[model samples]
Target chain A: MAARHTRNIVDRPIWKSKGEASTVSFSAFAFLFSELIQYSQTKVKSTAELENRLEVAGGEIGRRLLELLTYREKAPKRKTRLLDLLKFVHTTVWPYMFGKTADSLEQANAADDEYMISDVNLALTKYISVPRDMGSFNPGALAAGIVKGILDAAGFPARVSTHYVDVPGLSKPQTTILMKFEPSVMQREARLEPRAT
Target chain B: MALIYSLYIINKSGGLIFHKDFAPISRVDLNDSLRLASIWHSLNAISVQLSPVPSCTGIELLEAETFNLHSFQSVTGTKFVLVVDPRASSVPAFLQRVYQLYTDYVLKNPFYEVEMPIRCELFDAHIEAAVQKYPMMS
Candidate 1:
């Protein structure tokens, strides 16, 4: 029986043979991201189109991340409360996947239905240098799109935008990824509001 | 706690692309960063000069405090320096992940500078996460 258990070079990962998979490599991701950028570039003739395409791409990522984060585990108690969820996204969920908490979380000005979480940098776009021929490409923006997409797909209904916010004295410039919630979100939160202590 | 000293990435041409101080190292002097970078730059050049072309030390690592400071050089001439805690197991894993992030977010981002210290938000965030997981790090 032991002799019959030969490891195939292609599927040598013991865990996977037992029906488990492994993590993806960055090289693979680079090719994928590069292709994604190329695909996004092909759809648009203007800067706005490119930006929108990047956002849509990010949104797709957000959608996947949301599902992966929420349902990937079996918790004794499910996440409840708007603040709880926001915190989860800001610190727990974001860091788990992307590697850090957002730089800031702010309430939208003159808007009761909106809130913003700003990330000084988004990693997925780290290596990419938008060529002069290409409109300025920002991966953080795409990441914001991803977040928004995930939140929206989860019925949270929010908009995310990644912007390059200049900071004084840094080797690499900083990025600000802003997430804005929709008005309906506020109303829904109000209805689901927990009782005051 | 064992603190990470700093990180540096040098090209095969002796160009210093990136250098970062992960933890504090006093008495090393403020300009020590640039100086050390320069020195390391020369050392790397000399290392390559001494070795046969294309046969030079590729991905060389140096350890300090056993699990603390380490330097890694890739064949592509990208070097990663780590000043990590003493008990962080799996140095290979740590470096591999760092390199992965470098290749993904840093290298992929159009705006990122090669051989220069990384200032990408994603890289910082990811490193923060990794450090947070280090038991010795707060």
Candidate 2:
């Protein structure tokens, strides 16, 4: 048995080559997420607390996913600039997890440190119907957590929150993830801008 | 036509988490169902010990003069037991669909605690719909 096991390992390595795109079924994720929200509901008294719990859970996934995805890239390069990092999350991370790129990435006009990532219809919220009593509860908090986790891990510590904005023509409200970078992070980005150019 | 008399879900620790009778008139009382669950749990364990094979799962199927008992044990050690008429077909398939419903409704429900009795309205509704798909003996 031991000899055969050794022979098998030599012939076929366990790990798959890069860019294979490991994926889980949407229904499977939906089921697991539903359970997560339900379990979180039992522990929190307020919707804010529930969102915080979900964000924390999502943060863990984001941190790990960042590491895994970078390793999977053909040319793995650590994102150092703020724009590069945000674009990575927008183009790479969102599609990797949700099967589609985020709808838009926009800089907040009022503040240099603030930015927004919006989705017309968030995949996570597609099946979730927030209870009436839990007014304005957003499961998108998990996605915000993911963004925060990725940014923090990538050395761009920021505050991220999920919001629902009503669009005039759309039946469903769009989800916008707002991010506010720390003062220190903005200072670092300013210093690196000359070299980045 | 298949006659599925009842369905029961037993948790890993051998406690009855859910039970439903589909016959026109209920045959087993709550107490009787509880007793039967524990009895089956013990019997399953005993069968495993008695088996000469290394990894014998307790009882998969048991045929009697009147009814047939079909059991499917998931990887988590939870057992889904179905009691139906002797001529029942595709018992395993029916149980598989029932297990999927358990995961979706009972497990996914936020208010539900693991190993506790299932009382989810959505679960009950879906189970009824799934059972209806199978033509009854009538």
The segments of candidate 2 whose C-alpha lies over 4 angstroms from its true place after superposition are A1-19, A195-197, B1-138
lDDT of 1 by residue, B1-138 (tens): 535555566665655566665565553554665566567667766777787667676325545554465667765767676765666667767777778777766766544556665666656666667665655644
lDDT of each: 0.64, 0.86
Provide the TM-score for each candidate, comma-separated. 0.50, 0.57
lDDT of 1: 0.64
Worst lDDT run of 10 residues, candidate 1 chain A, spans A13-22
lDDT of 2 by residue, B1-138 (tens): 448889999988889999988876558888889999999988999999999988999899999998999999988889999999998899999999999988876766555678888877668778888888887776
Model 2, span A94-180: residue lDDT tens: 988888899999999999999999999898876565645778888899999999999889889999999999989986789999999
True contacts kept of each: 0.47, 0.25
DockQ of each: 0.22, 0.15
